[model samples]
Target: MSSVEIKVKRLNSKDAQFKQTLLSSLSLPMADDEAIDLAVLKILAEVKAKGDEAVLSFTKQFDRLGVSTVAELEISSKELEQAYQGLSAEQKNALDIAAQRVRSYHERQKIEAGCHSWEYQESDGTRLGQKVTALDRVGIYVPGGKAAYPSSVLMNAIPAKVAGVSEVIMVVPTPDGARNSLVLAAAYLSGVDRVFTIGGAQAVGALAYGTKTIPSVDKIVGPGNAYVAAAKRRVFGTVGIDMIAGPSEILVLCDGASNPDWVAMDLFSQAEHDELAQSILLCPDAQFIEKVQASINRLLPEMPRKKVIEASLANRALLIQVQDMEEACEIANAIAAEHLEICAAEPRKWAELIRHAGAIFIGNYTSEALGDYCAGPNHVLPTARTARFSSPLGVYDFIKRSSMIEVSEAGAQTLGAVASTLAHGEGLQAHARAAEMRLKK
Candidate 1:
C-alpha cells in the first residue's frame, strides 16, 4: 500500500479537538459482554461442581482432544525433559539466554521489592510491623493453539519462583493433541512443578477451585483470550489474578534525529501483535513524521504478517505533530502507554519526563522487542492506560503481607482508653467493653 493510501490518523497536538479525538480513538472495548460473562459463569459453575470431569469435557470440546480421564492430561517430567532435548540447538540456546536474563532480573526485584518481614518497638513497648510471605502456590496460564509463548512461561513462572512460591502450576491448551516442545522446555527450565493440558475458562476454573487432580492456586497469572480474561474477572475474589490486560500498545516519542525507518519498524513491532494493538508516534518535526510514514509504507509490505500490521496501523495507529519534546512527554504521560520508547539523541533526558509507562525503552538501539524477550524486564505489562494505576507483573505479585502487632500492659493502657472512647462514640458497646476490660483496674 502507498504511504498516502494508509489510513493512519494524523493529528496536530495543538488542534482544538485533539483531546477529544485522541480519547475516543484510544478507548478500548474493555466492558464485559453479557454473553461472554454468562458463558464464563456457566463454565466456572460446572467446573466447580464436577471438578476434573468438567475440565476433561471442556478440553475435549474446545481443544478437540478426547481423553476419558483427566489423568491423561498431566504431562510427565520425562516428557518435559524429552521436549527440552528435542529442541534444535539454536532454539535451546535462545530459550536458555532468555530464561537466564529473565531470572536474573526477577531475582534482583525480589531483593528490592519482594516481601520481607519487619518489626519495630515503640516507647510504650508495642511492637508493630509487617510479616511478608510468598503465596504457597500460583497458576500460570500460557496461550496455545494460535501461538506458543515460551516467553510467557518464563515471565510468569520465574517471578513466582523468585518470590519463593512453593508450587508453580501451569496450564496450556493442546489443540488436536499438538504440544509445542519449546513451551514445555520453557516450563522445565523455569521449574514449573506441574503442567496440565487444559485451557479456556474451564482451565481457569480448575485453577481457581481445586479439582480431584489439579490443586487450587493462590493466584493466576498470564494472558489469554477474551473468555480467559472474563473468567479471570469472575473468579477474582476466589483466587487472585494479574491485571486484566487489553491489547498491546506502544507510543514512540522521537526527537527527529533517529532513523525514520528504525522508528517505523519499532511501531510495526507492536502493531503486528494484533489488529487492536495501537502504535503512535509523537514528534516535533512534521518532515520527520512524513519520512517515517514513507518508511512505514516501504517496509510494511515486506512484513510476513502484513495483513494484521496493515489493519492495526490503519485502524489504531497515529502520527501526531507535537509542539516539542516537552509537549510530547506531556501527551505520553496522559496516554500512560504500555510500552514507551524515547528514541532520541539523549533518551535519558526525555525519559525523566515520563511518569507513567509499563516499560520504557531508551536510546535508538533499545527496541521494544528486546524488552519483550531478553532485555531482563517482564514483557507482561499493563495495557489500555492501566499503567496509570497498575504495574507490570513482578516478584511482588506472588507475595502477601500480614500486619504484626504486640502490645504490652503499658501500651494497652495508653491504647485502650482511646479505643474505648472511639468505640463508645460509634455506639458499639461490645467493642468499648472489650477495650476497657483490657485496661488495668
Candidate 2:
C-alpha cells in the first residue's frame, strides 16, 4: 500500500489533544475479550477437577491429536537428545552460541545481583535479614503450532536453571502431532527437565495444578496466544507467572539522521510479528517522518509477511511528529513502550532520560531483533505500559526471599511496649497481651 493509503494514524505533538489521542490509540482492549475468558475459565476448571484426563481430552480436541494416555504425550530426554543431534551443523552452532550467551548473562545476574542470603545485626542484638531460595520447579511455555521460537526456550529456561530451580518443565503444542525439532533442540540445550506435547489453556492448567502424570510447577514463564494469556491470569494465585505480555511493540525515536530504510525496517520488524503488534516513530523533523513513510511504502511489497505488516501498520502503528528528541524521550516514558529505540545522534543522551521501558535499544545499529535472539538480557519483557511497574524475566523471577527476624531480650523489651500500645489502640487486647508476654518481667 502507498504511504497515504496505509493510514497509520499519524499525529503531531503540537496538537492540543495529542496526549489524549496518543493514549487512546495505544490502548489494547485485551480485557474486553469475554469469549476468550469464558473458554479459558472452563479449561482451567476442568483441568483442576479432572487432572490429566482433562489435559489429554483438550489436547485431542484442540490439537487434533487423539491420545488416550497423558504418558503418550510426554517427550523423553532421548528424544530431546535426538532432536539436538539431528540438527544441521549451522543450526547447532546458532543454538550453541545463543544458549551460551543467555546462560552467561543469567549466571552473572545470579552472582552480582543479590541472589544469595544476607543478614544484619542491629545495636539492640536483633538480627534481621533475607534468606534467598529458588523455586523447586518451574514451567516454561513455548508457543507452538504457528511458529517455533527456539530463542524463547533459551530465554525462559536458562534463567530458571541459573537461579537453581530444580526442574524446568516445558509444554509446547504439537498440532496434529507434528512437533518442531528446533524447539525440542532448544529445550535440550537450555536444560529443561521435561517436555509435554500439549498447548493452550490445558497446558497452563496442568502446569499450575499437577496432574497424575505431570507434576505441578512453582511458577510458569513464557508467551502464548490470547487463551494462554487468560489461563496464566486465572491460575496466577496457584502458580507464579511471567508478566502478561501484550502484542510486540517497538518505538523508534529518531533525530532525522538515520537512514529512512533502516527506520522503516525497524518498524516493519515488530509489525510483522502480528497485526496487533505496534511500531511507532517519534521524530522532530517532519521531512524525516515523510522519508520513513516513503521508505515503508517502497519496501512494503518486498516483505514475505507484508500482509501482516500492513494490517499492523494500518491499525496500531503510529508515525508521530515530536517537537525534538527531548520531547520524544518524554513521550517515550509516557508510553512506557515495550521496546524503545533511541536512534539518535547521541543515543545515550536520550536513553538516559527514559524512566520506563522494558528494554531500550540504543543507537542506529542496535535493533530490537538483536535483543530477541542472542542479547544477554531476557527477551520476555513487560508490555502494554507494564514497564512502568513490572520488569523483564530474569534469574530474579525464579527466586524468592523470606524475611528473617530474631529479636533478643533487650530488643523485645523495647519493641513490646510499642507493639502493645498500638495493638491496644486498635482494640485488640489479645495482641497487646501477646506482645506484653514477650517483654521481660
Candidate 3:
C-alpha cells in the first residue's frame, strides 16, 4: 500500500473566505476540446452522407473491429439469450433482482408521475387539457470501452419501456471485437428492442440521423465519454438528449456521530469513479473531521483505485467544518450536489431542510452506493449543479405532452372576441381573422 498522505482542502463555514473558496473549488474544469468538436462534426456529416458505409468505417477505425456490413454489428436475440444463460448463478440472481427492483420503481413512477390525458368542459362546451404520449422510439447509449455497465442498460431502457415506448435501441461499444455478456443480458432483461455494437460519435450520429440499418429515434438517453457528450450536444435539435452530465459527485452532511471509517469510505466511493469526481463532508465537529481525515488516510491505501481516489481527493475533495446541521443544509442547497447523504442522528430533520439535490440518502445506513444500483431509484441524475433546476431520469423523461383543445361553435363565439382583441392589439391580423372565422356569423 502506498504511504502517500492525500491532501484535501479544509474549510470552516464561519470563515469569511469560506463561500468564495467553496464556490471556486466546486467549479468543474471544462472537458470540451475544439478538436473533439470538429472531429465529431465531421463524423456526423460523414455518417449523414454515406449512411451505413461511413458507420462501418468508423467502427473499424475506432473500435478496431472490421465488419463487412453494419448489419453484422447488430447483436442477435439468440446471443442475448445465450449470454443470459451463461452467467454464473449468483450473477444471474443479482441481475434479476436489480432489474426487478428498477422495473418496479419505474412502474410506480409511471402511475404517479406519468402523463395522462385530461380535459375539462367549459360552461360554453369548449374542452381543453393535455394529452400525454410516449415517444415512439428512443436510443440508449451505454458506455463499454473502459467498463461494462449492465446497470446503465436497466436504468435507461426500463424507464422508456415503462413509459410505453415502442422501440428501445441500445448502442454499446465493443472494443477489439469483445462484447460484455452482462451488458447483453441486461438488454435482454430490460426488453431492449435492438442492440448494436457501436459507440462514440458515430453511434450517436446514426441514432440521431437514420441510416439504412439503424432507424432514427425521437430522443437519445444514457451516459458516455467526452466525445459522446460532444456528439450528443451537436445533435440536440435533431433529437432530444437526456443531459450533458459532468463528473459524478457526492456531498455528505454528517453530525459527527457516525463511524469515521464509514464516512471516509463513503467519500472514497465517488472519488474512485474518476480523477475529476468530487467528494465533500460537512460536519460541525472539528475533532470528528480530523478523525475522518485520518480514516481516509488509513483506508485509502486499501482501495485498488487509490491513485484515482487520491487525485480526486487532492483536486476536489473537502472536509468542511460547518456551524451546525442548519448551516450544512444551507451549504448543500447552494452546492446542489448530485448525491447528498445526511448521516446524522436526526437525518430526516436535516433532510427536510435540504431544498435541492439530485438524490438524498437519509440516515447512516443508507449509502449512496445503494441508490446507484438496487435502491429502486434512477441512478441517472442531474450533475454539475444542474440539480438546482433539473431532476433525475424518470418515466416523465420518456413521454411528451400535447395540449388538447376543442372549441365549440358557441364557445368560439364567447372566446373569439377576447382572442381577436389580443391579436389585433399585437398587430397580428391573420391571428385575429382566424379567431373570427371560428366564431358564429
TM-score of each: 0.96, 0.96, 0.97
Candidate 1 C-alpha lDDT tens digits along 67-132: 899989999988998999999999999999999999999989888884688999999889999999
lDDT of 2 at 93: 95
The digit string of per-residue lDDT tens for model 3 on 50-156 reads: 99999999999999997899999999988998999999999899999999999999999888884667789998889999999999999999999877899999999
TM-score of 3: 0.97
lDDT of 2 by residue, 1-441 (tens): 534356667999999999999999999866668999999999999999999999989999999997899999999999999999999999999889989999999999899989999999999999999999999999999999667889999999999999999999999999999988889999999999999999999999999999999999999999998899989999998989988878999999999999999999999999998889999999999999989988988888888898999999999999999998899989999999999998888999998999999999999999899999987889999999999998889999999999999999899999999999999999999999999998878
Off by over 4 Å in 2: 1-5, 29-32
Per model, how many backbone clashes are there?
0, 0, 0
True-structure RMSD, every candidate: 1.8, 1.8, 1.5
lDDT of 3: 0.93
lDDT, candidates in the order shown: 0.93, 0.93, 0.93
Residue 408 Cα positional deviation in candidate 1, in Å, after optimal superposition = 1.1
Q: How many backbone clashes does candidate 2 have?
A: 0
The per-residue C-alpha lDDT of model 2 at residue 78 equals 95
